[model samples]
Target chain A: MTRLLGLDPGLRFTGWGVIDAIGNRLRHVADGVIATDGELPVPDRLRVLHDALVGLFSTYAPEEAAVEETYVNRNGSSTLKLGYARGVALLAPALHDIPVSEYGAMAVKRAVVGTGAATKEQVEMMVRRLLPGAVIRRADASDALAVAICHAHHRTSALKVATGTRMA
Target chain B: MTRLLGLDPGLRFTGWGVIDAIGNRLRHVADGVIATDGELPVPDRLRVLHDALVGLFSTYAPEEAAVEETYVNRNGSSTLKLGYARGVALLAPALHDIPVSEYGAMAVKRAVVGTGAATKEQVEMMVRRLLPGAVIRRADASDALAVAICHAHHRTSALKVATGTRMA
Candidate 1:
């Protein structure tokens, strides 16, 4: 079984989900959002995010990780702040020596819900169906779970290709 | 005397300069650039930058820090990448519990060279003059020194105001 951590990075709230993948089965391990105070300075906010992630990594010890890649936003400042949060997300896993893979948001939606243009509600519904009793409390956490499930599928397929085995 | 670290962040190269601020004198302690390999994946590149910065923080043990605030670039992607580097730069100091200050590019230039619109070459020349006998290296490092100098001036004035004293 491969334990994976998935992150949906944002400046104010970074959502994370952990799952254990065994063959084609994925079981939810945990999920939560690390929220930083908007009133804090940017450096302090980043510190809060980074420290929370470091604690999470120490607790979960996930073998591998995945992140949802950020797209350009209309607001330049917002995009830059998102990039800052993404940097912390990527850095945390790397610091733990966990290899990370990134999937575009559209790709994550497509893999989880079979459509690139799936709405948040559609994706959330599919995530609940895929991970029964997941108790997803927030949209950001749901998105993170979707990313984990998507990576689980991708990794399984890659494994099948490497072993020259047909999908069971 | 306050030991200050200043940073100029970029995706490929993060420049850092250390200086000791004593009364009205500024003495250079160290300056260098941390370069990340361009061919590496984004996560790995971030890891490289983060680890290098952690090491610098351990070595220098600066009491305070200043960073050049990133300006939005014409290219959104480029600006995002720069934010990633800036995030790491800001994070390292915060991790060390160092008080951080931000200076705009123009503000730093004005503080160091008496002109907000001073050219890079002019800033570099002034940095060399300010820290005579210092082997000024890359343009990025020079810019970092300028940021340090800028912070030193601002801090001194603020200290004077708080203490109700004239400039020494």
Candidate 2:
């Protein structure tokens, strides 16, 4: 079994989830958001995020890490703000020497819900169903789980292909 | 004497400068760029930035920190890229328990060059004059010194005003 971590980052709230991938099966471990005060200065807020992410990494010690790839938002300033949180999210796992992967929204939705254009509600519902008793606390957490599921599926497929090639 | 660290952040190169603020006078200490390879993954790139910032903090032990305020670029993706570096630059000092301040380009220019609309060359020239014997290795380093100079001037002015108020 390999433990995997998924992160969906935002300036106000960063959603994180951990799961154990046992071959083709997945078992949910935990999921939650790391929130920061908006009134605090940007650096202070980022420090909060950095600490929370490090805490989670030490707590779970996941073998692999995945994060949602950012899309350019319409508002330039907001995109920059999101970038700050995303940077911390990406850096935290790498700082711990865990390999990190990025998945786009479409890939995550398709992996979890079997559709690239899955709605928010659909993705949330599928995550709960796939994980079986996963108490997804928020939209961000649900999205994070979706990312983990996607990474699990991709890794499993690669393993299967490698084994088949060896046998042939 | 108060030690200050100033940062000018970019994805490819982050410029940093250290200075000693002695009452109303300023003395240059050091300046350089932290460069990262473009071929590496974003997470790896961020890890490099995070580690470098921490290394600098430990080396300088600056009592105060300042970073340049970002301007949203015309290209959204580039803005996000810069955001990642800026976030690291801002968070590094705060994580070290150093108070971080931000100054806009206009403020930095005015503090160093006596004009808000001063050109880059003018800012570089003024920074060199204000902090004698400073060897700026790059444009980015020059800009970082400008930020440090700006912070020193503002802090000195504030201190003077406080003293004046107490006397009154």
Candidate 3:
């Protein structure tokens, strides 16, 4: 069994989800959002996000991690701020010696909902069906869960290929 | 006497300089650049930068720090990458509980060369004059040193004002 953590990073809200994967079976463990105070200075806000992730790593103790790659926006300033948060999200897992995998949004959507152009609602519905009774609090948290599910699916397929099993 | 560290953050090169400030006198201690491997993955590169800064903080143990504020670029992707480095730079000092101050490029140039519009060569010349016999390694390192000198000057002026002494 391998435990995985998925992160959807943003400047104001960083969502995280944890799951355990064994072959094709997956179980949701936990999920939540790390919200930083926007009124604080950029550095202080980044620190807040970093410390929160550090705390989460201590509590969850995932063996591996995955992150949704950022999509650069048209607004340069906004993209820059998002990158700052993404840096913290990536760094925390790495500091814990957890190997991280990144998946683009289209890849994640296809993996989770079987469609690269799936809408947000479609992804959320799939997540709910995949992990029954998961109380996803916010869209960010749900997005994080979707990323975790995607990783679980990808890892399972890779394992099958490595073992000379039929590609599922 | 106060020990200060200054940083010029970039995705490819992060420059750092340490100095000791006593009243109106400033002396350079050390300066170097943390150059990340561009070929590596983004998260791995960010981890490399973060670890380097943490090592510097441990080695120098500066009481305070200053960083050149990031100027957003027209290219969103480039600006985002720069933000990742800046995030690491800012987080390191704050993680050490060292107070961090930010200065715009114009402010730093004005402080070091008495002109906000000073050219790069002019700033370099002033840094060489201020720290005589100092071996400047790279442009990034010199820029970091210039920021340190700027902070030292500003701090001294602030101290004098706080003590009710005439501004120098």
TM-scores of the candidates are: 0.96, 0.98, 0.94
For residues A78-142, could you state the per-residue lDDT of candidate 1 as single tens digits? 87888888888888988888999999988899999999999989999999998887898988898
Chain B fold agreement for model 3, TM-score: 0.95
DockQ, in order, for the candidates?
Answer: 0.74, 0.85, 0.74
User: For each predicted model, how many residue pairs clash, with residues at least 3 apart or on different chains?
Assistant: 0, 0, 0
lDDT string for model 2 (B1-168, tens) is 999999999989999999999988899999999999999998899999999999998898999998999988789889999988888888899899999989999999999989999999999999999999998879998998899999999999999899999999
Chain A: TM-score in each candidate? 0.95, 0.97, 0.96
For model 1, what is the error of residue B84's alpha carbon versus the real structure, in angstroms, after optimal superposition?
A: 1.0
* Model 3 DockQ class: medium
Q: Could you tell me which 10 consecutive residues in candidate 1 chain A have the lowest summed lDDT?
A: A159-168
lDDT of 1 by residue, B1-168 (tens): 999998999889989999999999999999999899999988789999999888888898889999998888667788788888888878888888888999999899999999898988899999999998789869889988899999999999898897885543
Q: Model 1 segments beyond 4 Å from truth?
A: A165-168, B165-168
Pairs that clash in candidate 2: none
| Highest TM-score scorer | 2
- Give the Cα lDDT of each candidate: 0.89, 0.92, 0.89
* CAPRI-style quality class for the chain A–B interface of candidate 2: high
RMSD (CA, angstroms), candidate 3: 2.3
lDDT over C-alpha atoms for residue B85 of model 3: 88
User: In model 1, which residue pairs have backbone atoms overlapping below 3 Å?
Assistant: none
Rank by lDDT (best first) = 2, 1, 3
